[model samples]
Target: MEDTDFIVNYVKSKLITINLEILIAKDGEDGVRKGQIERPNLIIADLMLPKMDGFEVCQQINSNPKTKDTRIIIMSTRNSKENVLRCYKLGIDDYLIKPFGLDDFEQRITRLLYS
Candidate 1:
């Protein structure tokens, strides 16, 4: 799977600098559970994960009445056309490939959060 400590820390720092609240999940299951409980505005997830993969997590979140409207961004190394298409079909707001630039990532976050 996906190891997201760095990504989480990076995003967390950026969000914190902007005075935004951030929550980090331990794994895919944790992510879904937290999403349901926290009802956050956005969720950035990795495609590969323990317990459950990101696709399942996304499906669960999308299927839930409480979190169906939540915006999702898939941040992963899986950059195949099929993967991107699948994410869009699942209604994900955006898909970011691995090793993304911080500025681009921040811009996407800003656009989603503000626009």
Candidate 2:
């Protein structure tokens, strides 16, 4: 989940009946830590995280054998080609721009999970 409480709660509410167990990370470091321990099938992260940015979080997760295969979806307000390309290069499965609609996010998640 993202660092902001509002975003996290909003996402959780939108996915209320999705049958997926959701976990929240306090920041990038916690995200990486939880990824290693929980080994979730998917991860949704924000670009501007405290302590470490999303890029570093991606590197940590990707490099770690325990969580390297986890699907990642990065959300950011940057909307820059370079950032998106960088995330792809880091093996993220999807990238979402900030202010994205919940329906669109759901569609992306569905595609990522079922495709």
- Which model scores highest in TM-score? 2
lDDT of each: 0.87, 0.90
Residues 1-115 of candidate 1: C-alpha lDDT, one tens digit per residue? 1456777887777778777788888889999999999999999899998888889988999999999998899989899999999988888999999888877888898899899
- Candidate 2 runs further than 4 Å off: none
Mark the 10 consecutive residues where model 2 has the least summed lDDT. 11-20
Tens digit of per-residue lDDT, candidate 2, span 1-115: 5878889988887777577788899999999999999999888999999988999999999999999999999998889999999999998999999889999989998898889
Candidate 1 residue-wise lDDT at 21 = 82
Model 1 local distance difference test score: 0.87
- Backbone clash total for model 2 is 0
Identify the runs in model 1 with alpha carbons over 4 angstroms from their true place.
Answer: none
Candidates in order: C-alpha RMSD to true structure: 1.6, 1.0
Steric clash count of candidate 1? 0
Clash counts per candidate, in order, are: 0, 0
Q: Can you give the lDDT of residue 20 in candidate 2?
A: 74
